[model samples]
Target: MFAFVMRRLAVAIPTLLLLIVFSFILMHLAPGGPFSLERELPPQVLANLNAKYGLDDPLWLQIWNYLTGIVLHFDFGPSFVYPDRSVNDLIAAGFPVTLTYGTLRARFKTR
Candidate 1:
């Protein structure tokens, strides 16, 4: 049993490393800055927004900031393009709906 668990951990570590490396590479492959949506804003407002989110830094640095944010801050940040609610709040609210859907799906899928 111990050997089985140890083997699983050994396999998982490489998978995690590959996922992180792929995420790093894929992030660079994507187009434009994160603030691409707010381009219509005045320069000063854009600066302020970037500063508020720490987006003024390099991409690697921003990724570090966001990863640290998820680890330490427990703040998932707002839902992108969703004006009415925060991302964390939206997830909290939607969880029940998702659970209900899953239950219904399971009930129907087995039929």
Candidate 2:
């Protein structure tokens, strides 16, 4: 049982890391960013905002920082539009609802 669990964990860790990397790539490749605005901001303001969010860093550095942040802090960082809330907060709030729905779905499907 111990060896089985360890093997599963070995696979799970790389799978999760790959998932994060793919998500990061897709997010960055998307047309607009979390900070996109319909109206243009001044150049200085835009640059400042990018720097503030570490968007000015090289892509590799950004990816490294993002992975390290999650590993060390278990944080998904703040919401893009909703600056007041973190991703973890949203997940916690929604988990109960999702859990109930999933349980119901599975229960009905097994019938």
**Top model by lDDT, which number?**
2
In model 2, how large is the Cα lDDT of residue 48?
A: 88
Query: Lowest summed-lDDT stretch of 10 residues in model 1?
Result: 32-41
What are the C-alpha RMSDs, in order, of all predicted structures? 3.7, 1.9
What lDDT tens digits, residue by residue, belong to model 1 across residues 35-104? Answer: 6765577789779877876668887786776666665786667565675677789888999999999999
TM-score of each: 0.63, 0.83
18-100: candidate 2 lDDT, tens digit per residue: 99999999989999666666777778988888898889999999999989989999988777677789889999999999999
- Model 2, C-alpha of 4: deviation from truth (Å): 1.9
Query: What local lDDT does model 1 show for residue 77?
Result: 73
* Clash pairs (backbone) in predicted model 1: none
Task: Write down the TM-score for model 1.
Answer: 0.63
